[model samples]
Structures are given as structure tokens and as C-alpha cells.
Target: MSTKRYCLTCDLKDDEALIAEYKEYHKSVWPEIITSIKEAGIVDMQIYLSGNRMFMIMECDETFDPVKKAEMDANNPKVQEWEQLMWKYQQGLPWAKPGEKWIEMEKVFQL
Candidate 1:
């Protein structure tokens, strides 16, 4: 079993509205997003949120490449649409550039 780890973060400006929207979208994430993840060899994924901060953890197989996954996402029309829609309820870190929503975190510890 591959034990790779990756992380991503986004913000929730308006707590109630953001939470509701997040929950609703997660109830059925876009099919293309799921397909893209699986295609990239992502084996397991989880997301956690506290107040306005969101974190995503992912485990990927040998074939996984974050850069490639990002390229795929950029090229997929459905994924683009989904991302655009999602941005309406999400915010990026202060350091993130204008069009960027999720920012990767460096892993500092593992046990």
C-alpha cells in the first residue's frame, strides 16, 4: 500500500453559508473530479475544517504526481467549472495569489 501524503487548504469566510455550501457539494463531488483523482492514482482522501480553515489529506499510489494532477484539472472543462463554482464559497490564504484557492502544505512530521 502506498503511503504518500499531500495537503491542501482553503478558507470559509462566512461560516454558516460556507459550511452549508461545502456540505452540499461534498454530498456529491463532481464525477470528473473523482475520476481525475482516481486516474492520478490517489488512493485515499480526507478533508477537515475548523472555523474558516480547511485542510485536505491525501494518500496516493506510485503513479501519483501532483503537478500532473494539476495539469489534468486545468485541462478538464468540467473540473474547471466545478472549481469556479466552488470558489464562490471559498477563500485562499493571504499569501495565495488572486486566482489560487488551495495551497499545499509541507509535511513536517509523521509517526
Candidate 2:
């Protein structure tokens, strides 16, 4: 299967306590959510942070479709619960679409 990489950006609440809590939550992601991620065709994912900004890199098989994955997550009660908790520390980028949480970043250069 073909593999694709996606880059996404989001903003975290600038509060230190919130950021700390966010990191703590990620230290042990829910098992159910982890299963959902694999089922969605995502093989690898990483998040990096600077100041209040966050960047996520994801590698997935050709079967992965962000829209489809999001739809599936929406229907999953556990994923929805996790997302609701995460919203406490997340903010959409200023230029993101109304309902968007993470904005896909355009790749400029690659070697």
C-alpha cells in the first residue's frame, strides 16, 4: 500500500497549566483512541510544539482519508469524549475553517 504523510498545525491555549495538562494527557493516550487511529489507516503520528503552536505529522496508508477518519471519529463515543476533553486546551488557527481544529499545512520544499 502507498504511504502518505500529512502535516497539520493547531494552537494550544497559551496557559502553561493547560499546556502541561495537555502534554500529560498525551503521555497516555486512550487505548480505544489508539485502536481507532490504527483502524483509520494511520501508522505513525507525532506532534511538536513551540510556544503555543503545535504541529502534527502523520503517516498513513493509501486507505487513509482525513475526512473519512474524522467522520468515523465523530461516530465513536470514546473518540468524541477524548476530543471533548482535548478541546479545553485546543484552539483553531485563526485562518482555519469554522469547524476545523487542525489545519493541514501546505508542503513547500522537500529533498
Candidate 3:
């Protein structure tokens, strides 16, 4: 099976204590969230932090449809709860739409 990779970025409120708390929460994400991700066809995911900036890498199967995933998430109470909790620490990029988080990054280079 072919895998597609996507990179996304977001920002955290520039508060040290809040950032620490955010990391702690990630250390024990709700199991339902993990299952939801896999059910969305996301085979692998990783997140990295730099200062107040955050980046995520996701590898998904061909079956992954972002729109479908959004619909599924909307119907899942656990996912909605997780998103609401995450917003405490996450902020949209400067150019992001009013409700957008994790903006997708453009790939400008490849070896």
C-alpha cells in the first residue's frame, strides 16, 4: 500500500507553564483519540515542538480522506472533547482562517 505524508503547523500560546501542561497532556492522550486517528487511515503520526511553534507529520494510507475524517470527528464526542481541550494551548497561524488550526504546509523541496 502506498502512503501519503502531510506536514502541518500550529502555534502554542507563548506561556511556559501552559506549554509544559500541553506536553503532559500529550503524554497520555485519550485512547479513543488514538483509535479515531487510526480509523481515519492515518498510519503514523508525530509532533514536534520548537519554542512556541508546533509541527506535525502524518503518514496516511490512500484511503484517507480529510473531509471524511472531519465529518467523523464531528460525530465523535471524544474527538470534540480532545479538540476543545487542545485549544487551551494551541493557536492558529497568523494567516489562518478564523477557526483553522494546524495549517497544512507547502512542500517546496525534495531530494
Winning candidate number (TM-score): 3
Residue 11 displacement (Å), model 3: 0.5
lDDT tens digits by residue: candidate 2, 2-58: 799999999999999999999999999999999999999999999999999999999
From the highest lDDT down, the ranking of the candidates is 3, 2, 1
Which residue pairs clash in candidate 1? none
The C-alpha stretches of model 2 lying farther than 4 A from their native spots are none
lDDT of 1 by residue, 32-67 (tens): 889988998899888898887889998899999888
Higher-TM-score candidate among 1 and 3?
A: 3
Error of 3 at 73 (Å): 0.6
Model 3, position 26: C-alpha lDDT score: 92
Against the hidden true structure, what lDDT does model 1 obtain?
0.86
In Å, residue 13's CA in model 3 sits off its true spot by 0.5
lDDT of 3 by residue, 51-74 (tens): 999999999999999999999999
On a 0 to 100 scale, what is the lDDT of residue 83 in model 3?
A: 98
Note each model's CA RMSD in angstroms: 1.5, 0.9, 0.6
Residue 89 in model 2: shift from native, Å? 0.2
